[model samples]
Target: MIEENRFPVIETDRLNLRQVTKDDAESILAYLSDQDVMKHYGLEPFDSIDDALDEIAWYQAIFEKKTGIRWGITLKEQGRIIGSCGFLNIVSEHRRSEIGFELSKEYWGNGMASEALESVITYGFEQLNLQRVQALIEPPNISSQRLVERKGFIREGLLRNYEFTCGKFDDLLMYSLLKQDYEKMSYST
Candidate 1:
């Protein structure tokens, strides 16, 4: 079990990362239900508002368990939920995990995702003391690939037929960054 103190609220210049709540259902539905956002994510668009509500409930349960950390990303200025970001598929024994994120289309191309990811990566390394973090990008997600690369995650290689999305198997590009590498880069900067 993760210690409660281990997970603290994190904020970046333009974003606030906090625990998700049932009240976030509408905001979650705003982005999650968009077909554009769901295209490369390997999941169907939310069928109804109830689906988003159920997801928020699941997120709340996970939060209480202290196993996986998820956050609802809100714009600092507007105080609106633009998307979600967090550590998914956590494996404590390995001191490693996969990071995932999604933002509303309106917020894309504005560097919000990159900024949020940088903050999360720093948190994973500095606060969580994790050894490594990984991200799997779908083949066609060039924007996401660039975002991870800018954050110092190296593209390891491709995992062919790695995920089933939109009724077909999709290739995924694996990327990872190590705590040691992050430390070195930060020290240099």
Candidate 2:
């Protein structure tokens, strides 16, 4: 089972990740509504503030149910939300989970995603005792693929017509990182 206290305030030199709240609706909507941001994410671009609110509610419920978690990624320097990242399809019995993330388009290529993802990945391996972490990305999202690969996740395979989003069936490039490998990398770093 996932630890009840899995929801943690994770911090890095330039970022802070915390629980998503209803109060974050506006900031979250900023990116959730952008086509460039939600293109690969399962849901359609959030059409209104209510869409963000509904998703936030869903995010909270999933954590409460011990099924998943979504961290609101905040940029400390600006003191505003710039993105979100977390695990879904978490199966503690199998010691594995799927990871997902998206940042505001304006903040792309700034290394913030790396900072946020590292904190979450470490938390999975160390605190949550997760044995494997996986990322399923749309085949066309080169940046996301590179981000996970840079962190040492290996491309596992491809899932064709894996998800139907944005009015069509989308393919996903599966990436995985094992806890043992992550530990080895951590020690080396």
Clashing residue pairs in candidate 1, if any? Answer: none
Best by TM-score: 2
Residues 22-118 of candidate 2: C-alpha lDDT, one tens digit per residue: 8889999999899989877888899899999998998888798887888999987765777988888889899999998989999899898988899
Q: Could you tell me the lDDT of residue 152 within candidate 1?
A: 84
- Shift of residue 155 alpha carbon in model 1, Å: 0.8
Model 2 stretches with alpha carbons more than 4 Å out: 186-189
TM-score: model 2 vs. ground truth? 0.94
TM-score of each: 0.91, 0.94
Worst ten-residue run, lDDT, model 2?
Answer: 180-189
Q: How accurate is candidate 1 locally (lDDT)?
A: 0.81
Model 1 residue 109 CA deviation (Å) reads 1.4
